[model samples]
Target: MRLGIIGVGHLASALVKGVLRTGFLTAENIVLAPRGHSAQLRAQFGCTIAEDNAGLVNACDTVLLAVRPQDAVAAVSGLPWRSDQIVLSACAGVSIADLAPYVQAAQVVRIMPTIAAQFGESATLVYPALPQLAPLLAALGKSYELKSEDHFEVGSVSAAIFGWAQALIGASSDWSSDKGMDRAQARALIAQTFISAGTMVAKTDEPVSQLLDSLATPGGITEAGLKHLENTAAIEAWNGAADAALGKLEKRR
Candidate 1:
């Protein structure tokens, strides 16, 4: 597949690296719009740099729309798109219907992939998922097929966790340092803990609550810690954050 990346920013760059690393596409088949950051991608991966967005679009069958949500319309609206071309949008809050007029393509799919995609570990989400797109999605990372636009928007609520997870890591690092642990060590240890937890979640079939129960044996340290967190309403605080984020997304609809 010949692919064109309209906005070669951080996320798009990661995706480019991932797809290349996974053998989803080759340097010869990929082209990117001319941007300051595009130079780095060209240097690192030898991806073709197009003279402009239109030039990139003309040369590729699949166009990845990675522009910022506010700039999406202006960026793709004037592009000379073909009816046979596929447009995959990575911009948040912009639905396929929202992008139809701008892209005017036969296929418009919305995707949400995290920065982890750069490392070939992103948990990507696709809306109005089609069977044909599975291979591309699989090459990037784990893919979830949401059946409707509403489901896709709601699925996006999980994206807020990147910031929240970083905040948590920072707080935990601070707590560890306050207890006389080395700050760098604390950071690495906590980061690894999250990674291990995520791996376990992916491998296990049991409910998360079952895992929690297994970890917190009666009268054990884990149980005590869990009780303390519960008393402080830590879980509720996380829910509140998720609710607030979901509310903002709902407002966009």
Candidate 2:
């Protein structure tokens, strides 16, 4: 497939690296619009750089729209979109309805992928799952297909949670370092701990509560920490943060 990327920002760059690393698409088959990190990507990966958005649209069978939500419509407006082409948008809070007028006959699909795409570890979210996108999504990382646009919007909040997870990892790492642990070792350990925890949940058939209960034995360190977190209402605070993020996304719509 001839893949084109209109926005070459951080997430877009990560995706390009991921798709290439996975051998899902070669550099020769990828085309980048002439803006943002397009030149850098072309220099690094030998991908073609289009002279303009129209040229990029004309050249590729699929275009990834990664521009900011506010710029999405403007960026795609008047473009030479084809009925057979697909426009996969990663612009958060921009609905498919908002893009329909500009894209004309091209099919628009909304997507949310974290920066972890660079390492093929993104928990990408897709709305109205398209069978043709399965391989591409698999190349990026594990994908969660939403049943509807509303569910997709709710799932998109996880993109913010991804950043929050990084922040939590950093804070835990710093705490370890402050207590005299080697910074690099502490960071690696804490990050891997999170990965192990997530992997267990993903692979295990047991309910999440049961899994947690197994670890948090009475009077154990895990139980002590869980008690402290409960006393501090940490879980509630985390939920509040998610609610706020969802609110912001809804507000943008």
Clashing residue pairs in candidate 1 are none
What tens-digit string does per-residue lDDT give for candidate 2 at 1-253?
8999998899899999999999999999999988999889988999999989999999999999999999999999999999999999999989999999899999999999998887899999998688999999988999999998888889999999999999999999999999999999999999999999999999989999999999998999999999999999999999999999898888778
In angstroms, the error of model 2 at 70 is 1.1
Predicted model with the maximum TM-score: 2
Q: Candidate 2 has which clashing residue pairs, if any?
A: none
lDDT per model vs. reference? 0.85, 0.93
Task: For model 1, give the 10-residue run with minimal summed lDDT.
Answer: 97-106
Q: Write the per-residue lDDT of candidate 1 for residues 1-253, one digit (tens) a residue.
A: 7888988897898888888988888888889999857899889889899998889889998888898887777888888899988898898887676778877655898899987886778888898687777877887888888888888887888778877887888899889999999999999999988889888898999899999899999999999988998999999999998889877877765
RMSD of each: 1.7, 0.8
Residue 17 shift from truth in candidate 2, angstroms = 0.3
